[model samples]
Target: MKKFLMLLLALLTVMVIAACTANEDAGEDPTDSEEPDTTEEGTNDDDEDATDDGTEEKVLRLNNGIEPSSLDPSIGFDAVSWDPLNNLMEGLTRLDQDSRAAEGVAESWDISDDGLTYTFHLREDVNWSNGDPVVAEDFVFAWKYMLDPETASPAAFLGYFIEGAEAFNSGEGSADDVNITAVDEKTLEVVLEAPTGFFLDLLTNPAFFPINHQVAQDNPNWHTEAESFVGNGPFKLESWEHDVEMVFTKNEHYWDADTVKLDKVHFAMVNDSNTQYQMFESGELDTASIPPELSDELIDGDNVFIGDYGGLEFYRFNITEEPFHNKNIRKAFAYAVNRADIAEYVVKNGVEPAYGFVSPGFTSPTGSDFRDENGDLVTFNPELAQQYLEDGMAEEGYNELPEIVLTYNTSDSNKAVAEALQSMFNEHLGVEVTLENQEWNVFAEAQQNLELQFSRSSFINDYSDPVNFLESFVTDSYMNRTGFSSAEYDELIEKGKSETDEEQRWEYLYEAERMLAEEMIAMPIRYYNTVVLEADGVSGILRHPVGYFDLKFADKN
Candidate 1:
């Protein structure tokens, strides 16, 4: 029994020693066996740390107000396009925070003493997002494209300052006759028909922006999609989901890309101010326009801002149509509205009743505002309105008034203003009007097609010049959706454009403004106020006086 016990103990000890040896063979070094700590945050190399909570940068959330009709600079002519284009593309010059002309693609420029010739020196370091060198010929191509009748750009009139541009647009001259020339790869020269003081300011507009010549030639639809959308600005289109949201990512190839702080910019197309405000409250938006319902409560708040946007809200009569064709009918409709009440009640954001087309911010030769110099030339007098309506009714030989349709873009604020105008027309002129609402693009198309009798419209300056407002009234102006034209008005504006003396030019413009008010060209409603809501941590955002809200210079805290 003793011998058997000893042998079993030795065998057990041998088995234990074999198990220990196997464990030693399977063991690993501590440095190699320790698990990796993925929880320690690390940057993504693909986007260069564009993650939401990364240490590098945050995305800027913005509201575009309306879905832009097109991203093509030659095709887009309104604030909806201009605002985004200002960041996505650049002109020879661009507007700074104060709406002053600033250097853009052109590093510097020299202007002749007569102001008829401008020579631009472009930066050699600049290239398109696609890596193509941006050259002077690009500007020449863009200018010619804008003036080409085939392009049918609504902003074709903007090219009129160039020598022979009018003749080219009118089909009387060749595109080659337009005096824009590329002296070299880095130099661009422009010759104007007359000395224009605001030429640099005009160049800041998107109509004068450059396009990649090869890209445009390769794909006519390149601008319509993100995959093909190439730009040379601080931001480039990453994704464009039509009518919903547009996303812009920073262009790593931009010459000044180092200065761009935001990783991306997201533009949410929320047409309704109420919806935009809700998004703002939900932290989905960084900026929004104050809804008319919330205007009174938020107008004085710290984040709410009111801008003296150099624009006027007006309802234009389709002068080519039946009753509106008569001057007396148009005048009667113009005088019928109580503009002050509308401004105070309907659009309660800081908008003032606009008695004339020119808003109050423009300075005259004597340093007084043009609007202050001409105070309320078109007054609100119901008696005169009724009398004029009666005369129009008599002239038309109609005992029954025609049904008028007032069309406006879809929005709570627009609907409110339309309802107020409807009530005013019913009360003051005994006219029954129908209010029609459509989406912004649809309404814009209808206006462009002249399919609406009366449509709500507004003019934000393309530049600070008064001609930017008055030029739309010219007979052939593509911006003239109203079809209201006069030879005298066109002649006066032509003289104003060429007039060199400051006082003389202002006098011409003043006369034109008087003519507009006296003839009751359109039913001027109110001058626009900025009226916006800004979230915390947003700084350096520029709300241009002409209604362009840009974020290229903005920073997110």
Candidate 2:
């Protein structure tokens, strides 16, 4: 019996082994195979794989699309084009290498007993590009000059946050009477009306950049004139021709002079992206962008710079005017137009559609989000919009809406959107819309004047905050050219500033946005990916929430 049991066990073991082998064979097919990657594009970036013996000089040439026409920090500067500007003229406090506010012109600041007052300590030995001692009074002058109504500075909006800034800007008070004062050679004091929560970020604005006050006073047109320039940051404008090219040389006297590796930085006006891309590929231009029409073919995992942006490209209506004054009309207009169609067709080339003023990934440290009832979010609802428009038309006693005018910038991408929207509004809502295109500079002025019935303008938040975009439209805001002011909206915004409870504050903000969106104050289009082309070796170009890409700390690798 023992011999027979041993034989049975041996047979069972063989049977189990054979079954396991059969299962393994059925699970995977040996005939299917993939080889290792020997392709050039799939290689990892390490020291050995970096180049084909490419040992080029560190001098990098950055080919930005447009040139900064005015070196004046105050002149109607677009932060989009001012990244290099802030590099040259830094603020007392500035966005860090990673977009957070850090010390720049001033070493430190101390707030007083009243939250409204602040005292700042400057870095003593800092010098200007011309080798002049940078004093506390330089910043003081810059602040006052911006507040002066005659300066016509777009940056003045930032100054308005300070005490008496509004009065000074509106010509109700002298620039001299503005609250900033130089306590001594190295100390500066500022007085504010309320606790400006984002004050540090406000200090990060170019309007606070120190300038040679004497030069500015001597030459009023110093912005456009060659005789009126000095530097507080890394680079100095050696030369610039309007709409042409700009040349910059490193500041020999910069406080961080030892760290600035690049000796010269240059920019040329090549607005056309394709022309710019060809130059970049040929090694003539260092960096270039794929134009809207060509973005998809160019965009992929390789060589793609992907990140969150703080800008919102919204469609605004002149609310103080007739058509927009009617909330129903606004609702009807929003319903009449299709956002998905706009997102797919009008805003082609990977631009994300905007559901509200604030985009995701953007944060507000002091405040909460500006979301709505569904919690700071709302998507296209054509059926709902149609009902609102139908009601509005009935109230206005009109079966068909009159012809509307939409003014947009003459950019290659913008024209496509405006033309597409014109058709969408006409066919979807039965509204006749005319598209009027104009030069960028001219179009900006017209939109600000409320001359256009409807316009497309974008506001990139100065800081990653809810207030940065929403507060800029509060009745008294300079950018509030549409005159869209509601007492309820204003109260809710002001309440949000002081509400100690975090959740309540957010609720109020969300309510205000819901009111605004429901009222159809304006239609949000989408958020843009700020694409730029820079030289291969250029690193440390600081990107900001506001489109200003300041490059002072930038060093060529």
Candidate 3:
């Protein structure tokens, strides 16, 4: 598992290479933007917001793109919610600046020789934002709640490693059957079904965050409002204006409060990239994602930062629906997409074209990238695509393909990608694909219900291991929005989980990726990259390639 740190170094190298290439291509010195302008007359607005003792009040402003689907740790599994929840609450472990799992609420832990049981000792000094002491029961309650069949948490699959977790979530066992126990006020014990190499890394996900057991019992909607929300992390929910904005104040009662430098964090719900960039330029937002149209121009700026992001932008084909129900049809659609063209022209960020589900950077036991070893399984082949489409039509006994509609969440980037895909289908296979858009919350719910015939989707790694990516397609996995079920695929993933030999386990995962591509359950577009511009005088904000943002140590002048 220590090999996961190699991904951090690889991402750092990508950052440096992207920065230098952008500078060279533009023929402009990025340092020019770093120089201060002596012509400015008044002190910066940030300086005016000082404390009573004449000390500057440190605040970091950002844009969340859209209103989060929910603030409940178990429910909000997407990137928009993950960013805020990561700072507002913490799990047993947290990702540090080096992207390794470090101690957080748990001060120490003991693992059994068999590696199936873990005993964690929590910090006695840790307290929730409401001044309530954090205890072992909080974790017990939260994990049970997430796995309770009624909660219908999309992230419940992440906890399947725990003994009886899958049975409880699938309604085959009761909550009492689960193996988590609060051994004492400060100690928690958990038993796993098998030895998991990346178990600690999995705990860093927000889905593992502990909840205030008493507070949640009293108010079922505790996470929906600022007054009722209780967290034990570096920041506390100060105010929320629904879809407009949210403000977070530093939590004085946090165990690591002394190390936190920012006084507050302000997040705006701006869905448009162009408007977000305008806000950053006008001093309303401290950080913003670069707009695709302006990426070439702003990518060379001194304040711009680029890094590898561990995620994939892809489209899901509902196999239960007509036309797509045919395997040849799905393969035809996947091959028709020109991934390289979309990545360069539509995305405009320095992202690699994805030919496989798992992104690059996971180092195998024999020192090889999982993606490179698997090689390119899907590509742009117009002749093959047309032949497959005709074969599918013949198999379905249809003279013409059925009308297809592609749906995506409302956003400038999503719209651009959807349009590009529509054009590709028309040019390569002569299929006219209609496009539709919906808000994030509605679209996400619809996709989960398997209502969308074809739709846009994304997957960010919940853990550093390659198995984290391959397991999503297992039969009945919540992340498997596509109605794809294969007994052979399911067996491969199951064997990979319990296989202890690193080489043999990786072989299972590699075969799984090849099977997914051969079936073409989903179309891969590009691997994600972090392209953002930060305001001057801001630093120390950590963005892990495989995890969410860490603003605990961020500072603003």
Candidate 4:
């Protein structure tokens, strides 16, 4: 009897040991694969983000570079390329899918019959990242600060529509003269010079977005560093390592957190297109955006990639002084560039050659006959370009040829494009072209100051409107690096906006585009479809027309 009892106890112990081993093997974790199980529970690699019961947590990764240019929306504007600022920061209004102005922070709005006064209604429950109530004063402060010439904001032109804004931006009046006030806590009123249809859409931009006035004042460099700022959108910046990596975490205080799928997002700022492709190849990255040159391999996996998106890539010449000041000189330079070769040999397929100022498929309620009446694309004619160069030089009273400098971003692709242009201009037009290379940030600074000669310039539009692109060179426009002003352009632009008839408006705009293109005030090359890489298990991310995507909606498997 004793022997039988001992044998039964041994058998029971063996069964218990077997059951424990099975549980350990089955309950493996995903993250633990990267690290050993040193914790007390000896959790599996995948279980790092999961609960003991195996329910997983959600996080995402996104790769972004540089901190924001400015937190003061009204002043340091241009969030088109750097869209997280525009996406994360809620404005008085927002844009709907149809690209029309819609409600966002403002529930609704009213305009006075006079056609000059505008009012906006704020959302009641909106809260800042620090849990501060978002209110009317935030906008007022942002406006006043931006308009203050002392602020030295790069986007000061955004304030031009407002009454007294021009004088204020021009340093005639204090930023205080620009009148925006709160009728009460929720109601805010603004007075503009005229009734502008684009004003509402402008408000939807980050340039007019309300900021936590106190926070912005407290952290002057908030946007330059990741830790110092806050976001009202679905995600808040979690970590940033310039030129390296960036991470974002879901904002719990977000007004719409339920729809915010990713709990965390990580981004790797890869400079090389090839290296970026490698990361996508290894499945380490969910999406990779590359120039057309690198997309040939991606063509095989049509299910894994999508390439067509609207954007423009063009060269900008400084028309403020020297040789470029002459219209024909600018025209001559434009004629020298062969955008077709670049798009075909450099970028791959899906991007069409840009023959007009505004790209096709890009539209606004305003008309889009931006091409000539002939319905023909602009052509590259070396002989005509040479004629212009000779005429410009003769008109300038210069018998000697002047050496022109072209500035470009130091990226390999950009340099290659610049080199092609250099060869074209020198070989055919008999112009000596000097090349200057700088980093992107420095390039932006130079552009803002009109310090660059012919700059490798093409930025995604802030809004899809032709006005957004054409109006960029408007007199006193912030993005107008060319410094070329035309009375005809100003008149046509004003007429286009003020005309009640849609056909007349289009007529005015088309007239203006023709003049601008013919004058060669600013060179327009080809529009490009943004190329983005897609990875499995990342979903719900949306890319804006301006080449920005939000990973806050993306979820990892």
Candidate 5:
């Protein structure tokens, strides 16, 4: 019976991969962008198999664009952490083959009619890599820990859907008041402040994953070292040489271990995409993301894939700082840049011009899109940009504007975009903007702390819901580092969250998006499209619309 189950799982995995390959060949991906990947128009040979001891080892080598900020589920919130966390941790819900909510730690769950209460039934056989049984209490500990001010989880606001989570996170209420509770060892319950249509979808985020309280208490730095890293997913950390390399091996203790085909996965922290691409070409890496400039030239055959990834790249102004504090100046900056030009020339990847914060394809309950409702909220007009700059100068009582510095992380693609924007500002607005580049981790920390005056930014949806994008601008949101806040904006978001009527809720969100566009708080650039190169032998790799790819089902020929 066990062997039959394993065979069935393997067959199912093949079917999923076949479908993904078919989509790639047809120039279709679920990334929400309509552009097709530029692929070579010919077939490629399969990867040659190497035999050792009469058996081929299924090892996959990949490269990461940046070193992960943190492995602790509560602390890490970016793609660097998310890519590995997707393998190292399992939450109550996970993105399934169809990218919908599916079973993870909790095999089944029920929601109350009021839509405010959720009860989860965990699997009995799941265990941490340390042989400790994963129970409901672990989730409770993790949730409360995130809400605790000391943890300082940048994603703590994600828990605000729970009844008292916001109050507890803000230090206005005690931990006991938080609505997350474990009814028993296998049963967990959560109470929300109101009906959130996307509550289940949100659980797929790392912030809601279970944490072994004992391990955490015994070693505060457990996640930093591979020896102490305990996970309950299909893979466990085998070793980690900080900022250099990391490795993972299949977890024999995982609930569905029989189905996890791959024996091991290797990750190298090669921050340069071009270098990673070179490694891929030289057969040193099995998979690598290609930079925009090389997208057309690099595809050797059938291994290239392009996906929309459902993300928006933008520039954020420090509203509390000088020059940028003037609303007209912010508007001027937005109007000066030509998004169409960047999307076509600079990004060249299958990306679309973004006129607002919420990327298109975020559909409401009624099946209508928010972006469709709010069309082209911002536009490019060099003459109007010049006028706005002059108005801003007059408002600030300055004859000329000071030199503004634009900051971005170091990458071939980022450098190109930054240079393009620098030229645009010089030509259109006549404002000389200096460009600064920092390494990935350093740039991320600076952006999080609002240490830079103006910086390149992007937000990939944590969940498919529009609230994921709208909530970032809330006054107390840690993601809101721009220091731009308005009571009216918060009220609109609140109303959208609590509104029972689907249409009315969408209206509230649309109003908030319009207000953000008019205020010019953040300049939207282009929507992201995930582009990558993979070995032909690699299959069953799942890239979610939110921009992270999963390796649980991956197998090498």
Candidate 6:
């Protein structure tokens, strides 16, 4: 760990020096350039490759880790789908090069003084891949469909702030109660239940992306195949080979097509990190995630790029399952594992040991870090673990504890972490736990159905706020797979969302996190930090700390 830190410091120093040198050469202040040059064309004077027309065809190759679970914007909420979807289709707002919410389909918007209503005016020139003009009805239909109870979209909870959306999703109200309307052909009006400061930021999520109502009506499975997919973003899905690869070509009809630098973006569905690293080395992929086992060896590599990522790696205990049903037993298992060792020894990718659900990097109204404000709530303590196990056994009136299984998806890093956890449980609590692994799709379905006892999970922030992490545990949230419910916790989260006073809202969030830790609802192992290797001459790829990749402005030599 110490060696890794030193190397990171050296890399930062080199970057600073390079930035200063570039600024001096350009005779401009470093702070003046806060965002990258997204409007630049890919035509470089030093380019060597040329076609018959004497123009080079620019393409960017990447690995998606696995085939997207689904291409439907509302259904594909995980990272595997998000990265490609973010480029293939756009929402009302898109994350800019600086990771700030910027206009996409919406040319401009107006908000009422009460902050309850938002009126977005769509860009007149924005057209889908099929050359159909994008209209406000697309947004309205997509939003209502996402909130429809029959759709069963996992991301439905994200739209709860919309007036009557929660009720409609819970089957207590009709779609008319959703409070979204197409004021005109290009105007979309939405009313929120309460004043939300992060409404624009929330719209950056792919779940809020618009769907072409006409296309969907003509074919129900428009998003399943590239030929049928209709998108109004910088890129359009050109081809899709399930579980193999996908190809995206620039959308000539895009509103901002002139700003798109690359002609094609190719995604290879390779789940193994080491294999991806090898591909990147052999010039098959432009960027690849660093495998934990090779982190130390590659830390000083010139191609490596490390940045803060807002997410958490954790394990969820199904309260309805045996052994984990008791709160005491859950706490026993949580306290038995050493998170620091896992972050340092097992997943050595510059991640910080996590003691709270919210990853570090969020600032409160008081200008303090949310994680630092809430100190370590859970830690390794073998003695406390033993005591809690005994108390839980006594409470259950059992001479022996029931068998427990730690389930995870098939991945090299996940397997390593699961094995380390198994050893820790056996050593600290004298509990012999079994480990199981399954494919990504199968495991995701099982976890969602609460079929797994204790399973590995992760949460990436959809917005730049601490509440995004806290809201996942709400009793009615589809993301809440642990089967743990608490009226107080739910109320606290409600207050956090509805409370107007920033300070008081933060107070609610802090209290809710405390309650979660006190009950040991989930065992937090580490906070994520993105570590990837990018080949030379690849630039302008926007990797937002709280969001997915933005390849619209990316260029390759």
**What is the overall TM-score of model 3 with all chains considered together?**
0.91
Task: Report clash pairs, candidate 1.
Answer: 307-530
TM-score of 1: 0.89
- Kindly indicate the candidate among 2 and 6 with the higher TM-score: 6
Q: How well is each residue in 314-423 modelled by candidate 1, as lDDT tens digits? A: 88889888788878888888888888877876677777998888878888889998888877777788899998888988999979777889988765456667877887
Per-candidate clashes, comma-separated: 1, 7, 0, 18, 1, 0
TM-score of each: 0.89, 0.83, 0.91, 0.82, 0.89, 0.90
lDDT of 3: 0.81
lDDT of 4 by residue, 169-255 (tens): 787987667878878778889998776767887776666777787888788676666778776766677776654556666777877
Off by over 4 Å in 4: 1-54, 65-67, 71-81, 97-99, 303-311, 362-377, 394-400, 430-432
By lDDT, rank the candidates, best first. 3, 6, 5, 1, 2, 4
Residue 42 displacement (Å), model 2: 27
Which tens-of-lDDT digit does each residue in 1-557 have in candidate 2? 24323433453354335333422111110000000000000000112112236653234455544544356777635643355567677778878767778888789989876678888888987878778777778888888887788977766866765888878999888776788888897898999867666688777766577877776777767667334567778777777665555666677778887777766666655544345555566666555565544455665635545445566776788876656667787866665555565555444455677777765554444443343232534465657767877887788787676667888765445655676666656555667788887765676667777887888777766555565666656776667767787787788877766565656766676676677677667777777654554545656655554556655656656
How many clashes (backbone atoms < 3 Å, residues ≥3 apart in a chain or on different chains) does model 4 have?
A: 18
Every candidate's lDDT: 0.76, 0.63, 0.81, 0.62, 0.77, 0.81
Give the lDDT of residue 204 in candidate 4. 62
Estimate the lDDT of model 1. Answer: 0.76
Q: Tens digit of lDDT per residue, candidate 3, span 248-339? A: 88999999999999998887766555555666777877887776666677879898778767878888999999999999999999999888
Q: What is candidate 6's CA lDDT for residue 485?
A: 88
Model 3, stretches more than 4 Å misplaced?
A: 1-48
